[model samples]
Target: MSRFTDFFVRNKKKLLIGIGGFASVIMIGFVVFLLNRERILKYAVAKAIQKVENKYPAKLKIGNARFLDLNTVLVTDIALLPNDRPKLMQIDTVEATVSFRSLFLGRMVFKQFDMAQGAITAFKQDSVDNFSFLYKKQAAGETVDSTAKKTSNYGTLLNRLIETAFENVPDGVNFRNLAVLFKNDGRTINMNLPTMLVEDGEINARMTITTEALTNTMYVKGVIDPDNYLLAAKFYGDNQSKSIEVPYIQQKFGATMRFDTLSLSITNKVYKNNQLTISGESSAYGLVLNHPKIADENVTVQNGAMKYVLTLGDHYYALEPESEVRINKAIFYPEATYETRPKRKIGIKINSPDIPANDLFASLPPGLFDTFQGVQATGTFKYRMNFFVDMAQVDSLKFDSDLDASPDFNITQFGPVDLRKLNQEFTHTVYEKDKVVRTFQVGPSNPNFTPYNQIPNHLKYAILTAEDPRFLTHKGFHEGAFRHSLITNIKENSFVRGGSTVSMQLVKNAFLTRKKTITRKVEEALIVWIIENLRLTNKERMFEVYLNIIEWGPNVYGIREAARFYFSKEPSQLTLEESLFLASIVPKPKQYRTYFDAYGGLRAYPRYFFKLISGNMLKRGLISPSQAASVSTYVNLSGRAGSFIIPKPDTTHVQLMDTLQLAPIDLLDF
Candidate 1:
């Protein structure tokens, strides 16, 4: 060590001189690079613009690029022309700050970008959108929200080049007064950003969207985490006079919906393990769902509040489990959820407490409410209902409803009716294709009109047993039939079969058309209550009217006409087998011709259905076991119309068929 030190001491002056000369040379090079920095920045801008133009059919222009400092570059008066359009995007100034450390690695990395005073316009030309590059259509066999791959190879290269241009944006990206215009088909929307600050994977944005065509304006402000797509902070939105136009809503609900003023506030919080919990409350005023059929009675939610919840990645939003919406005097608590599990599903349950009948009537349009013009109703009724759909198949639907009420109701036109005075005749109109054909005299007009006593006992029993076995016992409705029919209809998502009692059917025929609408059903139920509880009609009177007015064939009305049309016989002479066959087609009497085959015999299904009804009758004690056995397993309809003869019952069989007791009724049970 002493020898090395002595050697260095001898060469110390020369070594010091050499080190100073090397340092001077590096300093001179730095001075020269600093002087020519502007030239290098211009060259880089020209090259970037040229590269972008070569990839896409867009032109880029910049008035000048200058250095604000050694670490910052400012570009002024930039304009971008997409296709042949003039200046789709215009910016007054843009500044980027470079990372000094990245310069040592031979890369120009931006630490921040200030993109200010920019205007962008997007429009559709033919079938192509100006900003179509932002979205690539999904290929076949993909879900609706699935991510799609980028379309073009040039897009991939362009994206890489863009990423490289701004490699290290560590601090933030800021925007000021950026105008965005969008036009597509027949709609024009304009949005302006007042300010936006993006930093550390979080963004706080403020914007206002407006449309002159809709007379609407939407103001939105939110803090979002783009990396995880979370609302890390908060979001608030206000939409005023936002008239939404949706054709499907008009078709489905028979209405057009519009919101006059709406406000929403939301907050997102992370619980544990990065689980996101979002809660929000929305309120709207002057909302209307306008329907043409109810021109004067639009369904409206003048002002209402809704509370909701959403969990990220679960693809579902839930409403308050117990929340009530009060429109006028009616209050309904509805629980609803819409979910996505690759496929979509929906469920809704509504429970309403007792509501005044007059309040409900006032909410309905005159076109519907007038159907019960002569009935006086005074009371409250409560009902609960549920509906569900899974995987877009309506077959998975389940709906259940129940109504409870105690009303002081009656028919104004007819005072409390008397069963003994039912001998009076009346006129009725027949409807075909929803139009009245002719006013016809119904009761007592036909010479073959049979009295209730003269009507064959087995025929009466068969109709009662097939249609409604609980007819004499039930005051107005049969709970068992209703439940069964409700289940079937919900499973099919259609009202294919009706579970109406004889009393209800009689009222429907006497006062309403067979339109199968909710309005019709409600009115029918109201009328049934009036007739049963008010004693406007008795069980025997309703059954008699149902028999007289029910459709038997295309134009055939009543059992008397059906008997003559099918067998050229009187209603009193219909044999047990013939009566069963007649009862089988009561639901679709107009299509009865189809039940007969080419050989003019009752088809297998019709015969089997008859046996089913007959078997039920035997089980319910409406018909004797022997009487059911006597009916042939197969119904034989001769080819010659009206040639099938009615078989007379033996003397022993007549007494059994004649003496069957009527079901005892308890009117107060209603």
Candidate 2:
């Protein structure tokens, strides 16, 4: 018994050591499994992506992927391109997690998709964007059964994976340090999102944007269900000292603009059925506008406020369209509406009661009112306007407006600055190709400022139709035209088109330089407003000035000069086709100069341009269909007296007086 006990005690140590060795080996195996886990996960993900690509029309690539936890992966340098694009998104890092239950069920059910340091660039091709792919399309030549087959296997698995990742309502989706860029043509809009979070269909984002006019930060919180077309959100933005400073504004616009404060806020609440209620408020204070050429001049807005509420349904928003805007307590109501049904129609209205003009213009900086330095101004300025447009026949738009001042204001400075004298013969400063400003006068007493009756009806009609159909109607601005220009510019991603009014052009030609500066544009607009509102000159006078002073060709100024240069005819002798041809080259006279062959004959393209002008003239009722049909596309610039003459009534002997009801003559005629 004693010997057996000693043997057992001695062997007990060896037995315990053996058991410990086995445990250590098992522990080593487990460590090896953990070490290779990332590789296994990567392979699995790659395989799944391959399966997805086999059925769907997308490309997926991964630079490197590693397991963060048992069910989480940290993917680096991932790129997902779709629709045969180069790369739709380039993600620096993405941390994705799968639910334990989903992993166990052999499904890629994602619980989270947190992305960081990424850039998403979108391209707009023919108005179809990357997001447009979400709307499923039926495959061509596919029967119902075939279509069903298309979604089976890999497609079904991939769709299930996607549904599980998104429709399951993830706990959180975080996007950090992301930039979204949209490019159409030469224009680029960038938005930097510092932090964005999506939780239970709710989105919270804070972004910064820099544009030509302003740099601002926006905060947004919203709930959007694209599937149901439901959206609710709150937005807030502010631009104070951080706005584009005066120096930057001057650099960009060639004018200086300053605003003490600008703030905007909006709220949107939408019901489940897509009925949306929107409310917004905007305010700006201490606005200042200045142009270098207009010495000591300042246009100021001490304060401005706007508030509105709109309710939108499936068809239209802002049905009631109750809104108010006040600039220094000068209230105005501006509304536009759209109706869909039997015939689509749009209506716009702007109205305001008589407001004290001095109250608004008085805020200008000292010496800013030097133009009216010796003028005694008194009386309220009453404004009202109405416009209707048929969407189908946009050319047949109707507009009516009245801007009147009660009890005329006297201005003596206007006489010495007679705009008509300048129009007749003024300093024409040409920005030469060599970057030199060359100046010259039209003549000692140019006859180009022809009387209204001497101006050919066809020429008048052409200018009105091509340059500004609403020239005689609008006060100084055409909101609809400007909107169209802005939209087209944005869509094309470049400012290749313009919607400048004839009055604006005149102001630019007479008072401002053609430097393509934003400041110049602002100055032009301001002067046009003053001339129109203060009744500095009548519409006919403005039109006459514009026709006489505007550039027509290389060193050529005025319709009379253009007529002599192109056709060797007086302005009154221009035929309908010649008038249309002249209007077509107004915007690009220098470029179109080459359109004439070495023999001084118009090219085919120029003839085509004339035809285009004819189309617009016909639509605007400036030229009858018969007149348009009679117009010839060819233009012979041989400069022979009767080479290209097409006889028309010569109304030059008629009274050189306007028959259309003229607004009361200027209070102080120049």
User: RMSD, each candidate, Å?
Assistant: 13.0, 16.5
- Writing each residue's lDDT as its tens digit, candidate 2 over 1-670 gives 9898899798989988999999999888667757766555655676767754554456677888777777787888877676555466888998988764443334455678898999988777664455333323335332222223232122233333434333545566899999988765444567799998987878898888655555667676777453443345555555433332343556555777766655555543333344455566677677677775544456566677877665555454453446777876677887777666446777878877777756434432332432332233456677777877666665566666566666753332442244334434466665643263545555445545466778888888776766677778878787666655544444455774676888888877776546665545654665677687667778887887678767777677777788898888888898887887787678777655555544555555556556666767677677799988888766767464224334333332231221111111110111
Q: CA lDDT of each candidate?
A: 0.62, 0.63
Q: Where does model 1 exceed 4 Å of error? A: 1-317, 338-347, 372-377, 386-400, 406-427, 441-451, 475-498, 529-536, 633-670
Tens-digit lDDT track of model 1 for 296-324: 34556655665555433345545545555
> What is the Cα-based TM-score of model 1?
0.57
Cα distance off (Å), candidate 1, residue 276? 7.7
Clashing residue pairs for model 1: none
Clashes of each: 0, 2
